[model samples]
Target: MINAGIIGASGYTGGELMRLLLNHSEVNIVAATSRKLAGEAVTDTHRHLKGFLDLGFQNLTPEEIKSACDVVFVAVPHGTAMDIVPELLDDDVKVIDLSADYRLKTAAFEEAYAMEHRDPRDAVYGLVELHPEVAEQNFIANPGCYPTGATLAAAPLAKAGVISSVIFDSKSGITGAGINPSPVSHYPNMAENVQAYKLTTHRHVAEFVQELNRLDNSLTNISFTPHVVPSIRGILTTAHVFTKEKMDVDGVRKLYEDMYRDKPFVRVLDGSPSLGGVRGSNFCDIGFEVDERNNRIVVVSAIDNLVKGASGQAIQNMNMMCGFDETKGLWSAAAAP
Candidate 1:
């Protein structure tokens, strides 16, 4: 069994990692660190995992965590992962980062995030379906919630040379903000509110555009907008595309189905998919509509931000790194409302 350790265990992504790893037969969660919750029982900080994990949230240095586990998951914020990852890389440990630090290969974007590139020129991108080989071999950079949804929606169209350009309008639940409570995430304020916060300047834009372009050079341009909705979990991404030629909706669905047939985590919805269907699961549910008159197509993708978007993907990376079944501990069905 591979021993795993998670840094920043008090946050949403970190806690989700704990929940998923606890059920993995090949994994033994060795340590989880949080300075504020140091020495506290894991169950005390995250009651959802009551009786599942007995380990305490110890406050340990990066090196101390490296020594405790064969693999480490950096579940901290964007800038913070850069600081911790470089230190942990020195030890013989694999890292699956849940941040934007290593997702963009360009140095310019690193400066935009106020982080200096300290690791090797290469850290694998963890979009499991597209890059399964990378997922199996090395340390990974998990894709952002919005990018994951947007890319999967358009990748099939892009590969077929059917779309001229794409526009993405995505909505995410409050948990996407993090475990820490904020005014924006407050129930009273967020209820009945649908606000677009990061318009053109969102950091996730660079990743979405870059990765899509990387997948197909024919996808010349993309416009993305992200918003926060009132729900507690899930991300719904709608991709609007202008097709180069007329294509039947069934034909398009077949393309997506074929592309992801071998992929276990992605679900191609027969009709529109709501966040509720994918809640608490690692599935990226996709559905679409075709407007032949306007030469446009609209596709919707849904996922639980904490699961498919973050920690669940992290464990998926670990499964690949350790040569275990990709669905080892992630086969739990979605929780119904």
Candidate 2:
């Protein structure tokens, strides 16, 4: 069994990593670190995982983590990861950072995140379906929750080089902001309300552009806007993709089917994908329609923000990097109503 460790194990994503790893037959969770709750039971903070996990939160150093684990997942915030990652990588232990710290080019990262990168290197972008070669690397940089859904919604068309421009309007749950409570996540403000933030300047827009551009270098007109919905999980992205040529419904369906036919987690649905269909699961459900009159393809993709979007995706990366089955720990079905 692969011995795994989680740094920053008190946040939403960290708790989620603990939850998923506990069920992985090939993995043994060795350490879960938290600075503040160092001596507390992990279940105290992650109440949902109380009965499932018997581990306590420890305040372990990078050396301790490297010694105890074959792999380590950095679940800290974006800027924080850079500090811990450099230390973890000094050893033979595999590192998977669930942050934007290593996802972009060094120059692009400094501009979008507005922080100088201390230890920038080319780590594989861990969007498993789009780039499965992660199986060959020991380090992976996990994609953001928004980018994962938005990119998947339009990737096939982008790769076919049929898209001229793309606009992604995404609605995400409050949990996307992390476990920290803010005025936006305040129950009074978030319940029954949909507030749009970072209309044209959200940080995740950079990733959507970067990934799509990698597929079709000439494609550049990509726009993204994000909204906070009242739910606590999942991101539903509606991609308004404009093509150079007029395409029919069957043609578009074939493109998506052919692209995702070999992918395990990306489900091409007959109808629109809903948050409930993918909540609490490591699945991205995609469905689309061809607007022949307008020459636009309306594609909808849904994924649990905390699962496929974050922690579960991190575990997925770990599975690949360790040469285990991609779906080893993630074989469960979506918890839908």
> Best by lDDT, which number?
2
RMSD of 2: 0.9
- Candidate 1 backbone collisions, by pair: none
Over all chains combined, what TM-score does candidate 1 have?
Answer: 0.95
lDDT of 1 by residue, 242-337 (tens): 899988888998999999999999999888999989998989999999999988999999999999899898888888877888899999888987
Report the lDDT tens digits of candidate 2 across residue range 161-184.
Answer: 999999999999999988888999
Instruction: Please estimate how well model 2 matches the true structure, expressed as its whole-model Cα lDDT.
Output: 0.92
lDDT of each: 0.86, 0.92
Reference-based TM-score of each model: 0.95, 0.98
